[model samples]
Target chain A: MSDKKKTGADILLDTIYKNGVDKMFGLPGGAIIPIMDAVKDHPIDFILTRHEQGASHMADGYARATGKPGVILITSGPGATNTLTGIMTAQMDSVPMVIISGQQATSNLGLDTFQEADISGMSYPIVKHSYLITDPKEIPKAINEAFFIASTGRPGPVILDIPKDVANAVIDEDYDDTIDLPGYLAKPELDIDKIKDAAQMISQAQKPIFLVGHGAIISGADKILKTIVEDMNIPITNSLLGKGCFPEEHPLNLGMPGMHGTAYANMALCECDLVVSIGSRWDDRIAASPKEFCAQAKKIHIDIDLVEINKVVKVDIGLVGDAKDVLEKLHKYLEPNDTSKWIKTVNKFRKDYPLKYKKEGKLRAQHVIEEMYNLAGSDVIYTTDVGQHQMWAAQFIKINSPRNWISSGGAGTMGFGFPSAIGAQMACPDRKVVTIVGDGSFQMTLSELSTAVVNKLPIKILLLNNRYLGMVRQWQNLFYENRLTGVDLEGNPDFLKLASAYGAKGFRIRRSSDVRKVLKEALQYNAGPCLIDAVVEQHDNVFPMVPSGANLDKMILGFPQKRKELE
Target chain B: MNNNIEKHSISLYVNNKPGVLIRTSLVFARRGYNIDSLVVSNDSNNPKFSRMNIEATGDTDTLHLMLAQLNRLVDVIHARDLSGEDILQKELSLVKLECPIEKRTELLQIAEAFSAKTIDLTENTITFQIAGSSEKLNRAETLLHGYKIKEIVRTGKVLMTRGEEATA
Candidate 1:
């Protein structure tokens, strides 16, 4: 008879596979050597990330794209610390990710051993839940809980801190535990009372504004936001984080409001008498001043997260549920309320700002963003890394739906866009998913391209090669006497060469007008992952500046005289 | 503002989870009058639960809220509102002084009396970290007036409500 003895590692891998994990993004370590050894023989693919943050981002990307939990593994100490940013990002964005970190042996847990940091404790604020699995027998249950917590409503990162001995120790459990999530249960069921109240408010309003946020995207409520906007014939103004929630090019889209927002956008926000805020938390940035944010509006706030409902600004009518569901249900009550004058005013504002960029060459960031919106059409999802590129994408990309605009909003992690796009592409492979990243942010987790290539997931990447930390430089211009300190990149990698190095198709655009051709070629080169090194202006910064801690209404409006000259 | 009024601040360490703050808040709600400035944060190196600072205004009503809210939040394993009847309390404050070089010696002498630790010393400024009751920290601040006082960050008040039977 064939011997059926299996090591603890085998059982662990089996459990992970049983949970439907096809891949893991991580770096192997001494503590997890046995698990790594077992996985080497298993069918599961272990992606080797350049950094632990990259692994977390890959997992986050995978999760965001797939609507499933992304999995990651890292060693102890610095490895665990590196993932803090990604974890906080996931927490803020509510992305479902399961991170497995190695810990010192059970005996050394409290003894302050080498390569030991209280990882579980450090990640407290950022994770849904975490565990230190000291016993082999508890591994299956802990993992089951981790996956459950990470995937449930209010989705966020969860950590499993497994001690070395526990990972190696043998246990004879069936390992067939199903997820038990009794604490969390969230669905998009419209609250009837609030909906009726909101509908009543919407009916009475003359000039209404539709303010959409990240919550709308997560709830897949773009169609709902669109339906309401179309039905009401109301203009839509987005927060900085809500930039891509609505299609920027849409006739009714008024663009981003608050600090760093266009003057017209903020004016539209202030002018609207009735505000229909969907899936958005009226954060300080968007609100400007709490008292002045929507001083004239009869606010109707709809969001799934209840804590965000009245946290910042009070609303006339607050509805808690998934944005899509609430909007869908509210559709019946809405009766095509016309606000022609309101739409006209918003159109005027949009015309005034026009999401403008100087006519730099064809390879400028503006062309890249415009082309991305054109090539991808209204169906593809677009994500972006933090920096000038993120703001540029936010300023330009015309998203037709909610979830189509995935981004690292609150935490603003650099390497989130690419990996998230990979996840988005993986989940909806038939639909195009593109990522816009700056050279600075791209280097943070560019290795994720390997995961996409290996998985045969074709994701288009627009590397806006601005060889400086654009956002920080913008800050220096306003705050720090323009010293420009530590913002410039002296030696940047050749992205086209780098993309080619990773077995992916690469393109380079240097002229102002060649953007369309390069982008068209990239979208067509769909055999595998592709990267376009769109050489953009190095000094270009996201304008309509609202200096830090400054009120939103006080935005500089992008070199006022220059703006008038453009007009 | 009411000097004669008796005040209590309770600090607790509990598992941090969704609905924890709600449960703690519900406790106060059920008892009437809510917490004044209830700050929920994690204890250093303890990931499972957080150290919650519950500052309640009313006397009898405060106790009820603390008891009720603690019971409500599933993740909140413990809850307490400190009272003078039980437990030791500590408040930490870091004050940045705009002291000229000449007044630096006087400020240092005052800081020593309060057991304050000097955190920063510049040509025109001196910063000190003082740990004690809110009143004591305030007194130390008053003594450093000759120098320019730039900013003050008070850690608020954290209390262990008497006769400790391990709340968590």
Candidate 2:
């Protein structure tokens, strides 16, 4: 509203502020100095992370925890390149984010000048959209469009690379709010005929199962999903990313179904006559092998992105639209049906073959996770790094609401938990945020502990230190005849001292009996940030696991039995 | 899985922006499809938009998915598989052949048979330009194979519907 001319950076920040982005996560450098200077006058909070990768993941975590597009700003070249993994993680998981990278001056582009990079070109394949702004007049328009495109229609990350000179250049104060993207379509109209057909299919099926994915949570379709499940009396299973979409304690919930899925969930998937998938891609982990997944069942897939419809497993009815809208329309035509017999059969399987481990033994990672769940209750936001600990957390953590369970599911990126927990805590200051990370995965981005301390984020880190890359070691023990090479963590640092150096609280529990007491203290600690290093049994393996390339029903429950016995 | 790779003609209507072409082409590259020919220009009716015609070879299922992926790009308004439609396709090519005095008469006869025009002639080389279906250009190039060919430049295929129905 000011009549004075503004720099392109100010205009860009103003546009972002207008779009409801109040927080940004990133580091500053030379090329981005102008924008950093302009931030002094803005009301937005800029969280400075130790590394650009951490910043990007924080943004992704913030977006996943809250249903808002997280923002990231960093320098060009190495700083921009460092965010590729985080950006790809968001892209794979469909987390909404806007990455603003500072590039060299426009005149020096393609000349390989200092800190110059073709960031827009390099990120084109991974990003939903990318822009390289040369003219200062287009700053406001580009920022607005980037935010719009990032947060709509199967949301993903978008990149905007601004040259130094462009950020420093002056522009008129008048900002146009009109978005003129002729090709960008945010929502698609649902086909009512398709919905009616899907409803008919559901009504006729003797045995039906609902396979929920992260899209259900992303579209805020929790109530719709719960209503459909209750009205239809169907058992629901979740993908790894879809863990918290349906309440875990619900009687119809069959837990997560995949490679590391529960025995009952996998059994229910194999026995179902119809699989109604909502907002979930049939990735390799979920499907095992596309040819063998749900071989006896017809599938009804509903998703926002059309590309995910027949990309993996062909469905009998593929409805491409927003899940909430499609489900609302489908609910009208669906009659209240009952599958009590089918539910009885699924419940029998769930009761007979539950997720169990030996109670009397050295500390197990699963026990620690279950203890944390009991101590923290079901209201906290939980995250995990990629490893056996992640699978344990997914299986044990009981989440009752959407956006409460945040992890890098699609990308399965290591070191995502700690920083993501920080973002989640920042988004919801009143809610408790906990990150369960493995020993190997924790070291990858542990530098973000400093960020948590600096920002006074109350994030509890449950470090399951098994003295090895537990997942790979388990694989080696099972398949490679226990030939453990390069999987051992012998030279690991004393985590307590490291936490102290970062000005954070740290605790350790070496005995199995101390898990409940120590976890209670860690969760209750009102301090800024805390790390609990629990030394678990090194050889503990996640049970009810479907080995790679195996069928969904071929699970290795407990210790490895003979192949014939498993069959 | 079906392993048969067939040629597909895909037409795309996109915003006339700087990185739109690269964004569209990256989809093909990422999917491991080789673009045999590509033609891009501003739309005649709408100056704000452009038309891109891409000729690529891939399995039918993969190409079908690629069409969906291409349509997902922010700049692309619409994308369709034009191969199965009743469409007219054309490509222009200029071939420079080393024409010695002894082979001038024979080359001229071959060019005349293909209805190619002689764009430039030099002491030892002659350039022939031809515009038509890709099949016609291929045939013309094959007929001139006996002569010493110096260079060949081709503008990939551009397509339009046969009837009054517009693709957009």
Instruction: Compare the candidates by DockQ and give the number of the best one.
Output: 2
* lDDT of candidate 2 over A161-233, digit per residue (tens): 9999999998876656577887777998788999999999998888999999999998888998899899889
lDDT of 2 by residue, B1-168 (tens): 567689999999999989998898888898777888888999878899999999899899899999999999989999999987778888999999999888888888888988899999988999999999899999998877877899999999989887787775
Candidate 2 CAPRI grade: high
| lDDT score for residue A118 of model 1 | 86
Superpose all Cα atoms of candidate 1 onto the true structure and report the RMSD in Å to 1 decimal: 10.7
Instruction: Give one digit per residue, the lDDT tens place, for model 1 in B136-166.
Output: 9878877766567899888777665447455
TM-scores for all candidates? 0.75, 0.98
Which candidate wins on lDDT? 2
Interface RMSD of each: 7.7, 0.8
